[model samples]
Target chain A: SQTIHQWPATLVQPVGSPLSLECTVEGTSNPNLYWYRQAAGRGLQLLFYSVGIGQISSEVPQNLSASRPQDRQFILSSKKLLLSDSGFYLCAWSVLGGLETQYFGPGTRLLVL
Target chain B: AQTVTQSQPEMSVQEAETVTLSCTYDTSENNYYLFWYKQPPSRQMILVIRQEAYKQQNATENRFSVNFQKAAKSFSLKISDSQLGDTAMYFCALASGTYKYIFGTGTRLKVLA
Candidate 1:
C-alpha cells in the first residue's frame, strides 16, 4: 500500500525564521506531489504541485516554495517565514495518468510566533 | 481554471440522522473528477468518496454517498445514520487534467450526541 510520511508533525518557528517541511512517499514511484495549507476552520489552499523531479508549479503566491528533489520526495521551504505562514501544511501524492485520487500525509502544523 | 464551492459553511445533525452537505463547482473541461474529503479532529485528510465526470452513477462508500449532477455541476454528500465520529471538516474538490486540484472553502459538520 502507498503511504506518505511528513515530519516535525508539529513545529514552532519564530517570525522571520526559515522553514523546511519534508514529505516522502513509499510504495510508489513517479507520483505527482502537492503542497497544501489550511487555516483554522478553513478549507485547503493549494500552494504547489510537482509532476516530476525538478518540475514544480505554484498555485498561489505566498511566502512558501516547493521542490521535488526525488521521485517520491517533496520538500516545502521558505527563506523567511511570516506570521501569515502559520498553518497546517499537508503533502499529498497521486499516481500518474488518469488517477485523481490523492493520498495525503499526516501533515505538519506550524505556528510562527 | 476550475473552482469548487461549498455553500454550507457549517451544518449539524442529530446522531443516527441523515445530513447532506452541498458542493458546487465550475469547470469547462469534459473529463474531470470530484471528491469529498473528511478531515477529522486528528487533522488527517481521509477520502470519503469520489465521482468521475464520465460516470453517471454516484459513488458510495459504506454510509457515505454522493449525488453527482454533472449537468447542474452539483455534487452533494449524504451521510446516513451519522455518528459523532463523523464530525469533521468536509472539503469538496475538483480536479481536471492539469494535475491541479481546486478546493472549496469547506463545510464543518458536527453530529450531535
Candidate 2:
C-alpha cells in the first residue's frame, strides 16, 4: 500500500520567519508530487507540482516555493513567511503521467501570527 | 488550461435523504479526468469518486455516484442516504496531460439529523 506522510501536523510561527514543510511517499517511486494550500477550510490552491527530481512547477506566484530533492521526498519552503501564507498545506502524489488518481498526505496546518 | 466550477457554495440535507452537488468544467483536450474529493472535519482529503472522459458509464462507489455528462461538461456528485459523516467540503477537479489540476472553489455540504 502507498502512504504519504507530512510533518509538523500543526505549526505556529511569527511573521518574517522561515517556513519548511516536508512530504514523503512510501511504496511508490517516481511519483508526481504536488503542493496545495487551503485557506479557511475552503477551496484548495495548487502551489507546486513535480514530475521528477529537481523539476518543479508553480501554479501561483506567491511567497512559497517547492523543491523535489529526492524521488519521493518533496519540500515546501519560504525564506520569509507572510501573514497570507498561513493555511493548511497538503502533499499529494500520482503516477508518472500525472493524469491519474492522487493520494493525499495527512497535511500540515500553519498559523502565521 | 481547464476550469472547474462548483455552483453550490453550501448545502444541507436531512440525514437518510439524498443530495446532489453540481460541478461543471471547461476543457479542450479530448482525454481528461474528473474527480470528487471530500475534506472532512479532520481535514484529510479523500477521493470519493472518479470519472474518465472516455467512459460512457457513470462511476459509483458505495453510496456515492457521479452523473457524468461529457457533452454537457457536467459531473455532479450524488450522495444517497446521507449520513452525518457526509458533512464536508467537496471539491471537483479536472486534470489532463499538463500534470496539473484545476480545482473548483468547493461546495460545503452538511448532513442534518
Candidate 3:
C-alpha cells in the first residue's frame, strides 16, 4: 500500500514570512509529484510538478516554488508569503507510466494573515 | 492544452436519492484520461472514479459510476443511494499525454439528511 504524508496540517503565519510544506510518499519510488493550491470556494490550481529529482515544472509563475530532493520527497517553499497565498495546499503522487490515479495527501491549510 | 468544465457551482440532493454531476472537457488528444475527485470538508481530497479514453465501458465503483461519452466529450458522475457522506466538493479533471492535470471549477454537492 502507498501512503502520502504532509506536515503542519494547519499553519498560521504573518505576511513576509517564509513557507515550507513537505510531502513524502512511502512504498513507491520514482513517482511523479505535484503541488496544488485551492482557494476558498474555487477550483484547484496546479502550481508545480516534478518527474524526477532536481526537475520541477511550474504551472503558474508565482511566489511559490517546488523541489524534489529525493525520489519520494517533495517540498513546496516560498521566500515570502502574500495574503493571496493563503489557501489549501494539496500534494499528490502518481506512477510514472500510470498517467491516471493520482493519490493525495491529507493537505495543509495555510492562512497568511 | 486540455480544459475541463463543470458548469454547476452547487447542487443539493436528498439522502438515499440519486444525483448526477455534469462534466465536460475539451482535448485534441485521443488517448487521455478523465477523473472524478471528491474533497470532503476538512479532509483530504480523494479519487472517486476514472475513465480511460480508449475504453468504451464506463467506470464504476460501488455506488459511484460514470457515463463517459467520448464523442460528446462528456463524463458525468452518478451517485446512487446517496448518503450524508456524499456531501463534498466534486472536481472533474483531464490528463492528456502530459504529467499534469487540468481541473474544472468544481461543484459543491450537499446531501441533506
When summed lDDT is taken over every stretch of 10 residues in candidate 1 chain A, the lowest stretch is: A94-103
- Clashing residue pairs, candidate 2? none
Count residue pairs with overlapping backbones in model 1: 0
- How badly does each model clash, as a count of residue pairs? 0, 0, 0
Expressed as tens digits, the lDDT of each residue in B1-113 for candidate 1 is: 57899989999999999999999999999999999999999898999999999999999999999999999999999999999999999999998878778889989999999
Better model by lDDT, 1 or 3?
Answer: 3
The candidate scoring highest on DockQ is: 2
What is the TM-score of each predicted model, taking all chains together?
0.96, 0.97, 0.97
Local error of candidate 3 at residue B78 (angstroms) = 0.4
lDDT by residue (tens digit), candidate 3, B1-113 = 68899999999999999999999999999889999999999768899999999999999999999999999999999999999999999999999988878899999999998
- Greater DockQ among 1 and 3 belongs to 3
Q: For candidate 3, lDDT tens digit of each residue in A17-101?
A: 9999999999998899999999988888889999899999999989999999999999999999999999999999999764757
Sort by DockQ, best first: 2, 3, 1
Q: Give one digit per residue, the lDDT tens place, for model 2 in A10-113.
A: 99999999999999999989999999999985688889999999999998999899999999999999999999999999999998885899889989999999
Badly placed stretches (over 4 Å) of model 1 are none
